[model samples]
Target: MVLKLRSDFFHSVLLDEEKCKGCTHCIRRCPVEAIRVKGGKAKIDEELCIDCGECIRTCPNHAKYAQTDSMDDTLQRFKYSIALPAPAFYPQFQPNISVGKLLDGLLKLGFHEVFEVARGAEILAEEIKKYLSLKNIPKPVISSACPAVVRLIEEKFPSLTGTLLPLDTPLGIAARIARMRAMEKGYRSEDIGVFFVTPCPAKVTEVRQSSDDVGRIDGAISISQVYSRIMNMLDELEEQKSLQFSSWKGIGWARSGGEQESLNEGEYVAVDGIHDVMSVFEKIEMGELSGILYCEAQACVGGCIGGVLAVQNPFLSKVNVQQLVKRYPEYHLLDDREGKELVREGVFRRRRPFQARDVLKLDTDYRKALEKYQVIEHILENLPGLDCGACGSPTCRALAEDVVREKAQEIDCPFLLREKMLELSREIFDLASKVPQTMNEERGKQTIESNQDSGTATGESGS
Candidate 1:
């Protein structure tokens, strides 16, 4: 199998240079240290970025944003388009807005059909339970549902890649099922476009740069883009379609710990937020979390509801989801036979193996990398050890790494620059105070002549 590099992937989170103030806000907030302020502008390192949108959330100037597909452009591209709305999309609205009405609103938005990603989540839940039962598989399987979390593992915790559940995400599975259903209705595959109405930039990036299959999803549109249109259409509609198929368990996947709740059994631990996920991963690496069956990790704080592109308050959305959950049944539309058949066909399985990103490596050659590591340590020793972002890098250690990589100079640190300035001033003062040897000899001779004249004058006065 050919392993792909980080450069091969497409990142949806981007920096708007015009809006960026180079205030180091993004650099400080970025979980992976992917952002840096350079030349009075913020720059994202594509290799290091996981498209988690932490920078987007933290940027006070709104300089960071997700680049998603336009609904108009995507609809115009194909003869028929299907909207695959995520589970989190439902909670963005009021509780009075039924799931059926939300589906109807998407149809009014020019989508020929609307597929529920929650249904796909339900399918995945069943399959995951079956996978967990197998004795051959490893314990503590990690959920591959969140693209940002998966990418984080790829970039930061490569050893845990094997622990990731080798399954397609709910959105990916929904796209596949939606496209298949469209084809069954006599629509040509080329004429059909399946788009995910995503709440996060990571999903947009996943849709654009899917390693498993490029054709699974045509595009991803952010929730913020079509939120107003949906709200306006919701009130105008008189009749709602019976489009809701996902169960309460499926709908619960929008919030934190929802994936584990869907299983309803197992030693599962769900962790939300990228930093917290990292902490869990660290514990797993240290063998501190043994005997666990599965780990549900989400990059966003409140799962998908807290996505940077989401318009609703995450806490309010969580409450809305809970209300919606109470109204729906526990079981989803898919029966056990159909779910088993889909699993047998490998619809939920990942086609490509998760590849580790080599962004952490200092150099390609071992010897050179070791030398660079030593140099970075030496440079780090002179640094103030402050993680302040004033130096553009996220931490002093990062600045040292940058210096070793030749991307930055040691004087980039303000403290180091001040010390250098003071040393230069002292050197200049010493040079300026020294007189030339010839000038010193001439002054001495003049002083001696003056002394002799004064003595002769005193002797004449006495005579």
Candidate 2:
């Protein structure tokens, strides 16, 4: 299939058509059913995709990948550049590697300066506590830290969009601070490039399509892209830069439950893995989770450490993060007074409200959508309901919707196709059983009458 890439929206998650086998693995695993196998290739619906990197994680053929910036290109683009590494980055290395050593290694990779995203997380954490203290804001304010989860809510759970914490992500906050510091050092704003060493594709998307005017990132580089380079420079570093400024709380954001831990609250629930997060969101929509005051949701299984762009195994990375967290003191870039000042400045808050995506609607017109929905229900009743993905849709209902939308036929379902074939076979057998009218007439009338008389005599004798 010649997949048509969307021009209207930017997505980091993409497909390698040459590597795709059309095995339906990604379509089945995609939480939003954004993928479909068409004409022996996988196609991604850019609008529905959340850039969660689930397709990248599940593709056995390594067909799916995340598009990220090249380090060489990033370095050459600007006079000054800063590296904003996620909290998850620290855990990708051996536990023995000090955070300061990692910062020094980044400097070797052509970055003039390195800023920790964890410091942004620490600042944001303080701001979050203050926000939580406010009354009538909304119950169970969801964390907006995970860009993928935030997009997922926008696409699939739009009603809960209001519940999302209207705050800038750590990467955004870090990029903003890095830019300000660079400007203070005599670098022009346009000459300073802020690039994030991202752990996931979603962050890359966040950097590419950020709506924030203050904290715009120039580009995003995946951790996997620079892992080998960093590894090569680890031993040759001449000096440690004392670059470790973020505390244990900030660094802990790499793992599950770390956000809630920073809040120092017990009423909040931290859910990791995209599917589990969706399950909790469903409960919240049903009003079953009213007692909870906050929700920390991460799209990746072990939080950011489990992102597909990371090099190490997530479980091992989690342990590394836990060990690394213990080594750092509870130091923060911003004191309480400074944090409150920034909060008052609205530096950490989102400029625009989170809006819902209408990608899931069957039609733009309400009456037409209702008609299509009824058609889908009627078609779904006949489907096998196995959700086998053989029809190139994630579920039977999805196939039915596709049929209504003219993207597929009802016979796409193997069970329905088999029934159609059987029905045709029965019709053929019935047609073959009939004698030609000419042949029936050619047989003498006396022969037909004699056969009937013989049947009647046999019946009378048996009685």
Q: Return the TM-score for each candidate structure.
A: 0.92, 0.92
* Candidate 2 CA-lDDT value: 0.87
Candidate 1 lDDT over 1-463, as tens digits, reads 3466553567899889899999988898898998889999999988788999999899999999899999999999999999999999999999888888888888888999988999889888877887888886765899999989988998899988988999888887888778878888999888888999999999998887653342468889999887889987777654454677788888999999899988857798999999999999999988878789999999999999999889899999999999988988657457678777676766887865687877888998989999999999999999998888889999999999999888999999999999999999999999997665456776556556665877653322221
- Tens digits of per-residue lDDT, candidate 2, 1-463, equal 2233343278999999999999988999999999988898999987789999999999999999999999999999999999999999999999788888888888888999999999899888877888888899878899999989998998899999999998888887888778877888998888888999999999998888764354778999999888889888777765474677887889999988889878855698999999999999999999888788889999999999999999999999999998988888666557678666666756697754577877788898999999999999999999999999998988999899999989899998889999999999999999897665446554445455665877653322121
Cα lDDT computed for each candidate against the true fold: 0.86, 0.87
Clash pairs for candidate 2: none
Which candidate should be chosen as best, given lDDT against the real structure? 2
- Report model 2's TM-score to 2 decimal places: 0.92
Candidate 2 least-lDDT 10 residues = 454-463
